[model samples]
Target: MKPAVDAIVHAFETLDPEHIDTLEALYAPNARFKDPFNDVRGWPAIAAIFRHMDVSLVQSRFVITERIVDGRQCFLTWEFHFSFKRFSVGQPQCILGGSHLVLDEGGRITLHRDYWDAAEELYEKLPLVGSLMRWLKRRANS
Candidate 1:
């Protein structure tokens, strides 16, 4: 059997908010989720994270570049694009990043980790701090 995890991966690749409904069918009642800005438990909380993303982000889209599955875990390499609201010392801008996911026994995600170059993708999108951030990243990488 291909397992429900495959279908879950497909749903994310499609980038449709409605697809989240499929999660209810796939996840355990007490699934846990963790990401850059969120560390939440249960299906409702995880759904809220998606809900927030749907409402707060403008033109947000996720494109899965690769997927690897081992037993109950599925690691997804993805690229995301979204507009961010400018904060006190930042400019409204677009950002990009990758995600990694770990599924549970029922094929529900138990852990979600996001990996991205914050300086290049986020800090560079800032206002006054952008230049300094870019310089620091360049210096650190080189």
Candidate 2:
């Protein structure tokens, strides 16, 4: 499982639209992927999500920071770095998150779930919605 996990880490670090197709090789046909905004199955749907991200953002990339593996499952911590294509300034933004992945005997991922705060990690970064989100967060805290 080390080799399989290693390959997945490497693939994510170098993932791009041009090599989007390569991701299918790492996931099962009916694999499940769920994140803050999407819950999808199958490699094609998963690939579409990645493709959409590439189209919507500029210079997006993942930087894996840590991982914990046990048997056929693992948890990974990463930072997603990118700049918005339409919204506001061109400052680099980073979303801190983690993922839980379960692999099959063949080393293909069967389940992938990403954990992150939409309000803090994404919505709060927008130019307009950012202020609103921050206010809401403050209200919730106080």
Candidate 3:
């Protein structure tokens, strides 16, 4: 289980469009994956989401800073670094998030759910919506 967890972390850190085909090897055939914007089932669908990320974003990478493995489940805290092609061209952005992953006995992820703040991590980084989101956040805090 530990080795599988380590392999997953390594795979995520070096993941790219070229290696997108390898996603099926890391998850079960009917794996369920969900994030802020997508809820998809099956390895094919999961691979599609990653494929979209590779094509849509300027650069995307993940760093797994922490992990806790308990039995067949592992919780990982990661920082996703990326730049949107149309928005922040050369400026790198980061999203602090975590994932809850449940693995089968064979060490293949059966369920993956990512947790992140869409308002702060994504919407607030946009061009027009950024200003509005920031303003609203300031007002709410005040």
What local distance difference test score does each model get?
0.67, 0.95, 0.93
Better of 1 and 3 by TM-score: 3
Using lDDT as the measure, the top candidate is: 2
TM-score (all chains, Cα) for each model: 0.72, 0.97, 0.97
Task: List residue ranges in candidate 3 displaced over 4 A.
Answer: none
Candidate 1 segments exceeding 4 Å error: 17-22, 85-98, 138-142
Q: How far is candidate 3 from the true structure (C-alpha RMSD, Å)?
A: 0.8
| CA deviation > 4 Å runs, candidate 2 | none
Per-residue lDDT tens digits for candidate 3, residues 1-142, read 9999999999999988788887689899899999999999998889889888977696799999999999999999999999988886878999999999999999999999999999999999999999999999999999
Q: Cα miss at 84, model 2 (Å)?
A: 0.3
Model 2 TM-score?
A: 0.97
lDDT of 1 by residue, 53-104 (tens): 7665655667777777777666777777666543432223544555566666
Q: Write down the RMSD of all candidates, one decimal each.
A: 3.9, 0.8, 0.8
Q: Local error of candidate 2 at 5, Å?
A: 0.4
lDDT of 3: 0.93
